[model samples]
Target: MSAPDLLSFAKAVSSGAIRVVDLTQTLSPEFPIIALPPEFGQCAPFRLEEISRYDERGPAWYWNNFTVGEHTGTHFDAPIHWVSGKDLPNNAVDTIAPEKFIAPVCVIDCSADSTADPDFLLTVERIESWEKQHGRIEAGSWVFLRTDWSKRDYKAYANLKEDGAHTPGPAAEAVKWLVEERDVLGFGTETIGTDAGQAHLFNPPFPAHFFMHGKGRYGLQCLTNLDQLPAKGAVVVAAPLKIKQGSGSPLRVLALIASK
Candidate 1:
């Protein structure tokens, strides 16, 4: 297929020839934040206070004063979020090139596996199997691990247990292969973070964040609606707030699906 010009692409979207899917979980105070040890600094939850009412404070308008952590809700992770990427250029949300926000994506569905085992970890063999069916995972494409984990309610979504939250994610080797071999633009998940719940147990810990970002890639968390997309071809739009030197930021995620 020939590449569409910017104007042509706009017209196609405007004409409904291309459909947009909301991949974000709505941000609200009810949404759960990533649980951390009591000793460490924690991310804040979304909060809002209405500053005006039609009767008195503001007759003409209604407004709100809001506060939210950079990583709250559906969010993007910049390279600088981890110490490994601390010295890399354009590592923050504001500094990264805007062109990085849009890219092709590959959806690897591990729904059945994840459902059967809460601690499921994607391995390199599984990724190779996916490639056997869906073609190569091209460099610069967003690779999303679809565990159908987002379908759960707020309680099950986090799946916190005495041992820590039970969740599915890539193994350290898988993360390494995706970053160094497949060269994905980023790794995304339906959970609160790109890494698995038990990732800390791995050597160097949180390999997804460590390898991906350390090498100048990105991540998306709390994503939804992956079942609605094809295994390949969808283009993801993940633009984050340009927070100055910020580690990360909450952002709306959208997927453009071709409707031929």
Candidate 2:
């Protein structure tokens, strides 16, 4: 865009001609996180430590340290998060180009299906059907699955069973189609993972991680307010923390939508 175009956009934002929607879930200890099996490592929940509350430590400034997992809360998934893209260049969060932090988004609403079935899996047919209604999912765009899972209460949000958590996500075929055919920049979901909760049961388990990362794409998880976005035309800005060699990190996702 030219200098005038950029200036006009800034003015529009200042004048409410455009709306900025926050798509990130609140990061707190209460937020439910993904649980792992007894044999595997686990992600830590968000924690905060109060260093000083204007008492003694520092009268002038108040700062506290906190601990949390890389994938805690609403976070970004770098290509390096999966084995498929481990060897790819710029696969880590810190190394990825800043230009990629922003991109057009295609929100595919699967709320009804997900509400009917906790284990609902997005299929290629569903994606194609959505395309029939909306325009084609252009390359380098973020395709977000809107399941409204973020609205669930704490217990139901995790929805863990004796076997594992029951959640909605993309099927292996859908992941393949998005990566191979559409060439999306990344995939986002209201669920904890880009893949289904029982995705391990699928052939080539966790296909979203397998195919998307393998192609050096990205991922956003634990997102919210997708219902506020239109099917297309919104631009998503998801910039991850610059953790060196980090596989993933919590991020603040914002969607820029033009006013009608």
Candidate 3:
């Protein structure tokens, strides 16, 4: 089969045959960051400093300087983020191939399960069930876990308790299966981190980070608008900032979906 025509694809999007859905969460001071134990260094929240306004330093144009942690808000995680992948070449965002920025996606909706239990874990059995109906997940495609957690308000979104955060994510075995069995491009979540909030209790701890990154796969966190996309046939564009030796970076994720 012939490859898709780039110009024609762009025209389709412009002509409304294809709809683009923004999957990124808005970056703001209120957007919650992952909370680590007190002994660990904490990621900074989004902050902005007014460099100029229409009436100020630059009358012709206005701009502001922003400061934020690489992993703040909706972000992309590179392989280097975890010590398991630290020694791998091209593990950092800047070193990753640009070709990886775009890929096909398979969204597994677990909203009902997550709603029933915030600590819900996406097991291999659940993934198999999804595949049975939607067809097998393709190789080199991103596997997104849609929990509808992005729809919560600030307080509920974080869902932090005295013990820690309460959120849903894939089980350790699921992550390994997706990477080894499916050869997926990556794993994504609508939560602050790719791993479940209580994943620390897992054998390797933060298994998503451990297995995914360790094997040169990627991760996307704090995404939104998964409800706008189909379970399959959606292509995700997740381009992170080219930060040198950086573990991760906030990104503007967009999904291209064909309109029936």
* Residue range 154-234, candidate 3, lDDT tens digits: 888889999899999999999999999999999999999999999999978999999999999999999999998899999
What are the per-residue Cα lDDT tens digits for candidate 2 across 10-129?
A: 899889899999999998899998888879999999999989877778887778889999999999999999999999999999999999999999999999999999999999999999
Task: Quote each prediction's TM-score.
Answer: 0.97, 0.98, 0.98
Tens-place lDDT per residue, model 1, 1-260, is 34568778888898988999999999899998898988999999999999996759999988999999999999999999999999999999999999999999999999999999989999999999999999999999999999999999999989999989889999999989998898889999999999999998987699999999999999999999999999999999999999999988999899999998
- Please estimate how well model 3 matches the true structure, expressed as its whole-model Cα lDDT: 0.95
Judged by TM-score relative to the true structure, which candidate is superior, 2 or 3?
2
lDDT at 217 for candidate 2?
98
After the best TM-score superposition of candidate 3, give how far the Cα of residue 42 lies from its true spot, in angstroms.
0.6
Candidate ranking under TM-score, highest first, comes to: 2, 3, 1
Provide the lowest-lDDT 10-residue window in model 2. 53-62
Cα lDDT of all candidates, in order? 0.94, 0.94, 0.95
